[model samples]
Target: MLNAIVIGGGLAGSQAAIYLADNNVKVKLYEMRPNKTTGAHTSSDFAEFVCSNSLGAQSVTSASGLLKEEARLLGSKLIEEAYNNRVPSGNSLSIDRWGFSKKITQIIENHPNIEIIREEITQLPKTPTIVATGPLTSDSLCSEIKKLTGEDNFHFFDAVAPIVKKETINFEKAFYASRWDKGNADFINCPLNKDEYENFYNILTTAEKIPLKSFEAKYFEGCMPIEVIASRGFDTLRFGPMKPVGLFDKRTREEHHKNYQFYAVVQLRQDDKQADLYNLVGFQTNLKWGEQKKLINSIPALENAQIVRYGVMHANTFINSPKILNKTLQTKFNPNLFFAGQITGVEGYSESIATGLFAGINMLRHLRGEKLLELEAKCMLGALLEYITFANHKAFQPINSNWGIVEKPQEVEKLKKKSKEEKGALLSNIALEYIKEIRNGYFC
Candidate 1:
């Protein structure tokens, strides 16, 4: 019997272990937590979530939502576990972070075919292994990964977000509405007049930012701090993420006048179902907490805003996927070696789990002497893997699932009058059909 070692017991590692063991492959899972700590993780719990509790949107039309549905149809343990312990957050699948990880740890621990090992792995094993060490991988093991992949092949950065307590928000000043009233309008919009926006921008530009540690490189372009975006120009933020387009001010009872464009708008999206916590949408920052409080509260709606969580940025590490892995998520150099999760350069929890399930299935195929399965591009899972494994390696950065990543079918495109929701529903149906085809073949 072949044995497989899975490093890092986060979502990716745990999912990989479950799949391999289900196929009767002896599997060992290694996690470096209470014994070894990452800057983000707070506990020894396997698959600990260092950020927000919500997985992603749950609607089948959304990329993250569609990915969850796909995982569920394919019998994904993570998906099933998430749904069972779900905490309602309107349309999103938010969870109690502690409850979520504990459940996963229990399931993995109870599985007879898998063994859990708690220790920091500074070097790769001589035997076949899957490295799912996540973005906050330790310094020592990162060095070994760099040596194997070649110097300069890996990238690093601090990607941080602030957290706020749900009770601190001033509900009187903020309004709940999604842009264009398109979806559930679940997000809270903090509207700003031109004066309020410009004043806030002035404070943002001059605010003292936390300096990067000597060992840490500058942030990756994808997750650059909001301050950095502001420094580019006063108008940069307005055009970038803070743009107030698609939103109409309900209080004024008038379409926000075109000439009255906001200097900028700060958006808060629901972080959990209780409406107690909301994330500063597009407000990732490295600002010192005191400075953040001073500057952020300057906004009209936030003058008395109680910040429950402060934003943070930390070093993130990942491997060069296009060079090292194939579409099935197995290493080209070693059929028995598999890679999954954030280390594969797929961003977000949903994306990470999707890759894990794919890696697990492929690992089973190798053990059973069956042909490996590679999903079609029309499917969300297939499109994600194809992008990671085939995109131009030199320009590659970690990616979250989005419409741009998948090509829409001609039938959906032909309907000019179809709303976005209608189009999404059509595409979701197609994806489910594709998944059913794969599942039927495997079981039959």
Candidate 2:
């Protein structure tokens, strides 16, 4: 007789279920794996980490660490179990994959208010539901989601360029300008001479690439990875993504006076409203992270770039959250329905859990006819949700929990000349204090 249903027992779904069950809300948790497996999953366990065994750094100075601390403050069941089932990983919260999965499975199956259902939910239920089906969501449910959100808002593949914190990008070597000076000076242009272009080109062509999974083998001609384009020929990238056509570097041109002209240029577009983050304009890549760092560093403008999210070209199923969901993770189309996890355009283990944990709390509130929590952007989890819900929909991409996403608290804004670690510690302190206030004030 449970009216509340949580679909797809992944990280987000599982966290949502646990939070709701702990609050005495009977939850029917559904898992589709072992009955209908995804391309990545190897087991039927709830909260199974499909990718990395390491969650992230456990130090509060790190972004993932701040999220975990806030989750701990909010009594997150998954975060507690992650630590309890953790293995030796130094400062990183790494765990024994099998043991962690089994522990989580045991907990979910034994929870008194939870009903473990071994089935696939193809249809979105009319009753209150949280669709945390994740990136590898099933075809049928994908279809249902597509119908609910429309085809334009749903994406089956992720072709994303690396995003860098604007503060880290060496502006001395880069200048903001629009192509042909036709629009606002919106693009950060990194002008590369012949030597720099060739050097970047050589490294990119030889970089290690992650072979697409069997299910993700299909490559669209127009949207091939940057590495693939480089492999075609030496001049391919110069004419393509790295093209310098119409980009008149007015700043450097004024300094050099017609002596400086770019052989090729790399462009970065403003990714956030704050303009604090910018993404490589056409740098959608599948290169290994090590190689990505090497190639990005070769560019003069990106010599010391701090990549917030790396370029990822993978078979992923995520909705355009800014277009479809509120900051509460509830869909704009249906108030009774909610979404969390990778499907909500949030990447990483802790981030998925944060969304699910919040959705669960908000779902319970929704059932009780109370105002849902739209956590303030000062908190790590709140900032992530705010980004997904309010980011530009035209180029919305999945993001992990990164310091670049968190807003500076007004109190922190007053203080200046602090080291990066010190600034991060200050932000973490603000987030923890904010979450603690919510935990104390909220009834559920």
Candidate 3:
């Protein structure tokens, strides 16, 4: 029987352990929390979401959502737990962080085939192992990784958004609606008139910001703090995250939000299943606590909003994957050692979970003397693996799921002029078909 060691209890680590255990492989899962904690984590729960509680868009036609769907089809325990503990977030799959983590921890602790080791791993494991210690990998283990990867590892700062009590929000000004009504009216939108938006923008751009450590000051483009985004220009945020497109003032019977334009809008998604808390969407920040409260109060309807958590930033480390690991996430120098999660250059919670699944499945395949499986490039998981393992090594950066990385199918290419949604639908169908084939041929 095959046995494996999985390091860390983050999303990726938990996922890898579950996969191995379900496949009859004995797994020793190590989590260095509640014993020796990462400064960012507050609990000893498995798969603690230190950042946003969202898992990104929920449409299979979208890249991020497709990755989640792929994991679900493959029986991802964390994804199942996420759905069970889901919160309202329109077209996104957001979960109650505490409940979500607790559920996974309970299940992992009780698994017969899995052993939970609650201690910090000071060095790399010698046996077959999946090193999924995420971005906040311990310093000593990082040193061991450096010796293998040759010091080409990179680090970037990731910021978290603040969450507020639902009752504290002034509902008179904050209306309920999804971006385009794609899903339920799950988002609480606070609209800003031109003057209101201008005042808020001025204050936000000039707000007191937190200072990052000198060695860990670089920010990832995908997770740029709201203040950093606003610094670009007056309309920078308007065009980027705070754009008022696809949303309208519900107080008026507006025509599909396309006919009218607003200055800006701040959206909050439900942070818990009870609908008692909601997190500011795309409002990740590294501002001082006082400044964060002040900045949030400047927005319409949020003047008395009670913040449940303050936004903070931390360093996320990822290796130059293309140069260090193969498409299967196995290190070139050490075949027994595999990498996953944010550390492998795949960003976002769902992407990290996808990599863990691949690593676990491939590890099982390696032990079974079966050929390793690789999904077609038309699939989200396949595109992500290709990008991380085959992209330009020198210029490689951590990547999130995006259609740009997906390879177009021949049928999709034949279409002369297709809308983005139509193309996405075609690509999604192709990807799912490939996944079905994979399940039947390999997983079955």
Q: Residue 444 of model 1: what lDDT?
A: 63
lDDT tens per residue, model 3, 131-189: 99999988888888998778657878888899999999999888899887677898998
Top candidate on TM-score is: 3
Listed in order, each prediction's TM-score against the native is 0.87, 0.67, 0.96
In candidate 2, stretches whose alpha carbon ends up further than 4 angstroms from where it belongs are 151-314, 391-393, 414-416
Predictions in order: lDDT: 0.79, 0.81, 0.88
Cα RMSD, each candidate: 3.2, 12.6, 1.9
> For model 2, what is the error of residue 152's alpha carbon versus the real structure, in angstroms, after optimal superposition?
3.2
Q: Which number leads on lDDT?
A: 3
- The list of candidate 1 runs beyond 4 A from truth reads 22-25, 85-90, 182-185, 213-222, 248-263, 391-394, 407-426
In angstroms, give how far residue 132 of model 1 lies from its true place.
Answer: 0.7
Worst 10 residues of 3 by lDDT: 249-258
Per-residue error (Å), model 2, residue 73 = 1.0
